[model samples]
Target: MISPLGQSFRVSKVFKRCPLEIQGFVFSADLIELSFRKFNLILGMAWLVEHQVGLDCVSKRVTLKVGDGEEVVMVGERRDYLSIVISTMVAEKLVQKGCDAYLAYVHDTSAVSSTAEGIRSVKDFSNAFPEELSGLPPDREVEANIDDDPNRAEFWLENTIRVFDELSCTPEECMKCVVSLLRDSTYQWWNTFVSVIPKERITWEFFQEEFRKKNINQRFINQKRKEFLELKQGRMIVTEYEREFVRFSKYAWECVSTEAIMCKRFKDGLNEDIRLFVGILELKEFIMLVERACKDEELAKQKRKAMIEARDTRKRPMSKSFQPQSKRSKETNLRMTISSEYSH
Candidate 1:
């Protein structure tokens, strides 16, 4: 019988028709709310089973007791197997959630530690839990902590198994007791959720290379390597233009060094060649050329502006004036265009 507060059940049975043998059953109950979108009316069951004997003697069976005292048979493993049953409705829901739900139980026949060490023992599994859940109460507490963190259920269940192991219950025994808490239907739903949930970025290849290096300064080296890889991915490397700029900058420094060499050689000159070099135009000549070019450009600009103004003025074209010679230079007339109405 199931307790009102929800507890696990233990049972043992022997069939008279089969070869004489003993078997144990561990059962628990759990409830799951439906999304109400599909309204699937299917029913199902799941079983978790484990066997530790050399010949593999563990087994789990599930049968649905339907209305009118009838029984519905489901397909699954027979002997030395762990299995879970899921209705069509539940399977669809799990498919939607992106996970598979299964019920499995471990069996232990080890006389050394009994079922406590085999199933519910904390040492049997690794706890890959975050730091947030470390300080919470045990899963078996009368009430869950106020945090109500989404991952609490899994943490609580795993922690409870560890506690059970300390209390002398085997892992197999604890699994049997908690098997029903996980339904095949809900398992599928959880799987789907996990698949679609956003995950933090993780690139293992770079990390692995750093992790394998053998050195006393591995941590610092790995950190630097990680930063470099990130920078590469972010495209912080130099471009063609930047590379050219750096090359030219180095050449400019070389020019300064050459100038220093020239000055020293000039001071040591003892021949006509050195005297001739001193007379040649140097840095000051370059500056004079630049100033001349600038003055020429400014003068050209002023001449162009004056011509434009003269052409645009409201005045007649200038007539050619002839100088009369002493005896009968004929008076000459020149054609001129006149526009007295010009705006300027």
Candidate 2:
């Protein structure tokens, strides 16, 4: 279909003149099987149709109806895929604009029943539309080559890599350290992202409208639930795994951000020693802290257990002493019963 953005066919234009290909002015029939492989690029067209026609679900047809009751019906299978694609495209834009894409997608569900059919949340759309946004330029393009100062850069990097190789740390620990460094570098990029969001410009209603066009939140919830089940199957609680997952997720975000910001500066002329020193310092510090904390917690738990055992040992002797008191009470009761019988 033509969108106002000129990305696709305009309904008015198409409707006005029935092409020979469409056969007898039946645009409603020809819309089927017309797929935009990169649907995100034509998001403007999808939005225009979603707003004007609205979605109507009948027993026989899943229809996208424009003004004047022009409708496009499709096979049930195609309807699902098309709806998911359209919804995801709309959701991604709302998310890019810093709106609450998930909530917006929820409202879109009622407006277009099939919009949220295959999708559940903004995150879902993110997964579905990963290639939609080209995002920022590559880090390498932004910075000069590290090898521009070949000898100095190589020598410094060699030492850093050698030291890392000589260390007895496991691969997991090393990865964590590297990730921490990446995150530290990208903090500025995150701030930049926040700064760009026009808080005042994006209203809740606008977000809701966009969200309804694509069900993002439901997809997110469903994905999380699936993850929880997998964790449970592995004898772990979803909540516990989620904590670790969140930590790594933050680290991943930071890594991308840091690389984008520092690569240019590092390439420009920064000394290798300074870069290596800064990168390694925070990771080393974090490892030391984590190790110390783990040791202390273990020591505290052992000490608590020993104390509990000692208290139980002392109580055992006291319990034995109470055994004699019970025996004496039993004897005294027998004597009192005998005396009462004699008096009677």
Candidate 3:
């Protein structure tokens, strides 16, 4: 047998047609014994072809067609495949050389969900897996091949950060995911940037700062800050205006450093009718101010609707038969009808 690095080893024995079951699908395969310790078993090309297997390297999953014509999928455990062990002497040398070390506890929970004791254990230690990390990541996008537009860069950075926050990912995990998602010029830039920096110091914050320095311009940020200062609710509804306000507030943090300043700034930008009612309350909380503004806007809308209804009622013409006519007016109408009939 030939190894991946082209080293040759003699096969000790071949076990033919050994039954193997994966995910409830049974198959027979030929197993060969070799002098290799890295893996317990490796499927050969002949077995893969015989089973009509399909492999997705990106997702690390395999699909196999069974005898009954049903396909079964098997997901790979990435950590198992990538794990490595080091001797105590090698570890000591690395420690002496000032190498950073991180320890991760990986629990095998494949059978935990089906067992009673495992269920109780999970309930007792529920904090181990946070609820936020259970679901899929957020749907926000960071373009793989982004341009030099500062707005797009800022959006990408913010969106990446938001996704990391939602997933409760650590700095190391964030860096790994971000590096994987980068492509084209951005990927090249990352490669060059990381070449000189030590791996231990290349944190998420450091990456963000370097990325902003390369992609975002100070002039664009200043412009956005100015826009935030000049922002007004205008024709936007309370909810929409509030969304924009929050989106721009980050650009001008100093202006809204305090809760009172934020509330006051938001109130001052509201429409006149809503501002009149909301401003008088002098609410300190930003959330309360927003709620009050929404309520006042609703009230104003109802008042306008009521006025419109009343005006329409007044302007509506009375029925012709219900109108009171003078005798002279009735006589003139009767004469005109009689004259029209005689002419016809």
Candidate 4:
């Protein structure tokens, strides 16, 4: 599939289906999801040039009866196949996956012991994640990310899927059995309020569909990203500004795809003095920028304090050294002054 940025990635392996053989014709069954948001499965008609597969036009249906077995009746308008499409996220994900595949292919001849191996057996999977619920502590909420960590969600996703694969259950089962592990209000809200499903129709795909319908919203994510982009420290203290930036980090995935971009965006939203201070430093990492901003602000505060103290010292009156008069001398002076006043 081609991404929006003109990048291409492979999704599936090229494989021929086990066909239903007739006098010389063959057919393969296909499972297709009937959604406008879906991509079309390809079928080759080169073989049909010699052997014809009859098509029925009525009832907006097509029938291919090349086989002696039961004819295939496809419920769709008959037209030549045109094109396929994929979502932008899906395309990018595929491209990322393809990179790994390309690397493996290029290094196919490398010794296994030379490379890092992470594969584990099914026993390991079963041991680590038994097909049971792992309840959470009370009031705990499983957030998308944790404590300003950008990789938290990705880490969670990797482990969650590994456990899910080990369980070998439907998504509903996974959700239900997993409920014991979470006592958070968010999880409870999802379990008690959002998890309404017809028992007969419960499936992993349906669960994902409902989950996205109830939880994930692209427009909401986009709005949060916009807020992150426009955020400024303004008059807020360092800690407050950092908190706000961290709070909205998860939504702005694209903005932080690279450390350079993250650094630039974060630098743009900083206060002028902080920006100038941070700019002078060779900071490339987001964490480094946060640390430096905090450090610089503190230094600025100390400098201002020192300047104030110096100004205050300069404003004060200076005291000069003076000798104390003897008691007898003071008394004599006082007596002379009193007598002079009386004579006057």
Q: Write the per-residue lDDT of candidate 1 for residues 1-344, one digit (tens) a residue.
A: 33222233443442222221122332233323332334332122331221221222333334544346654333446542222332544564554354644547687767566442244533323365544354533333344431233235434544665666544343344544443344454445434544664544212232222212311144543554443222220221123322333223332343325544433322232133322443343423423423433344456558789998988663444432334353333232111222333433
RMSD of 1: 36.5
Q: Model 2 over residues 1-344: C-alpha lDDT tens digits? A: 54322334324222222222221233322133333465522223554465343444543344454447665554344435577756766765554454642223335545745533454555444556677756533322333333243333334444544555554333444444433332322334333543766856444344323323333344444554454333221232323333443333322343325543323222222233233333443333333423433444456558789999999999999988877556888899999999999999
By TM-score, how accurate is candidate 1? 0.13
Highest-scoring model, lDDT: 3
Report the Cα lDDT for candidate 4. Answer: 0.62
Per the 3 Å backbone cut-off, how many clashing residue pairs does candidate 3 have?
0
- For model 4, the stretches where C-alpha displacement exceeds 4 angstroms are 1-174, 178-209, 216-219, 318-344
TM per prediction: 0.13, 0.20, 0.53, 0.37
Error of 2 at 186 (Å): 31
**Which one wins by lDDT: 2 or 4?**
4
**Candidate 2: what lDDT?**
0.42
RMSD of each: 36.5, 26.5, 24.0, 24.7
Q: On residues 1-344, what C-alpha lDDT tens digit does candidate 4 reach at each position? A: 65344444455434445465544555664432332244544344554432355654565565565435656555655344332333545644655444322223355566665421354444445556575635423432344422133244234444666787653344655666544443455355556744475566755565445444445556666787888888999998878987888778778787778888878877888888888999988689988888899998898889999999998787664422355778999999999999999999
Model 3 ranges off by over 4 Å: 1-144, 318-344
Per-candidate Cα lDDT values, in order, are 0.37, 0.42, 0.82, 0.62
Error of 4 at 268 (Å): 1.7
Preferred candidate (lDDT higher): 2 or 3: 3
